[model samples]
Target: MTNQATTLPESFRELEPYVADWALPTRQERYDMRLSKTIDELGEFYDAIAPRAEEAIGYLNELDLNDLPDDATRLLHLLYSMVLVSYPVNVFKQPRIPDSGAAFFDTVAEPSV
Candidate 1:
């Protein structure tokens, strides 16, 4: 694999170091970091990136999925995982606001039958 960093959207540049070719963490590594960590504890990472969530999704959506390189494919899967878990569907009626008053919001998923 190339040692060069994968190009990412401006909004995702902060993650460049973490996702660099030689330093990319495995799915298990990412999960291990989150074990027993509260959202409050993890806010530093997400709070900064949450604003760009939509843009990231848009960029991913525009990609030709079938033709992505290994690095790009891995990054795509990582972003999808981030998006899926960050927004709880059935657990809450509305997006929860932090005690610090940051107004992060996401669409509430419809009730499941």
Candidate 2:
């Protein structure tokens, strides 16, 4: 978990010791972290949407989710927004996420590559 938290270059200072805990995990570990982040987000409303939801049908109206359609590629990001931003953003124009109780962040670095 800590390893996953350090991947952000911006948070390097805060994560430095966390990073040094191990030489570094492999590139595949990096990819897994990204994938896990997507999966972790599913918990936010998974119970409500899992077998399915009316909003899922509505947002996807005239579209087929089960079909290996074009938009299916974005299934995770779309779900992330629906859970993290879209649904709440609709009711109020503000951004409010429960976890982190709020996010405090800093853009500390920019990649040369």
Candidate 3:
């Protein structure tokens, strides 16, 4: 959504390009998305977001978790997605788990932000 880029806080607007695909709301969604993309795509996202992660976390820490602004909530989701992709980018070097054919994780519930 173009609106996501415009709506994100100015400091993180550079990451807006990824919001549409990566700002998912659940663990399962994020995990599935990681598997769907190629390693190169995951690396692209990792390279862009990893450097700013601490800063983003610091920014989020300042806000009230119970009442985060919509932009902040989206940013948090983006961060979660980053976590899901890091494994493939750093270790496996592949989108899906190595040699885990047809196996997937099914989460009954995800922690609320």
TM-scores of the models, in the order given: 0.47, 0.23, 0.91
Residue-level lDDT tens digits of model 2 in 3-91:
44443232222322323222222323322332344333434334333334354445545555455343332332333333443333344
lDDT of 1 by residue, 1-63 (tens): 244444654446566653432122344444444443455544544554466667766776777
TM-score of model 2 relative to the true fold?
0.23
> Rank by lDDT, descending?
3, 1, 2
* Candidate structures ordered by TM-score, highest first: 3, 1, 2
| Model 2 whole-model lDDT (C-alpha atoms) | 0.35
Report lDDT (CA) for all predictions: 0.48, 0.35, 0.88
Weakest 10 consecutive residues, lDDT, candidate 2? 15-24
By lDDT, the best candidate is: 3
| Model 3, position 7: C-alpha lDDT score | 54
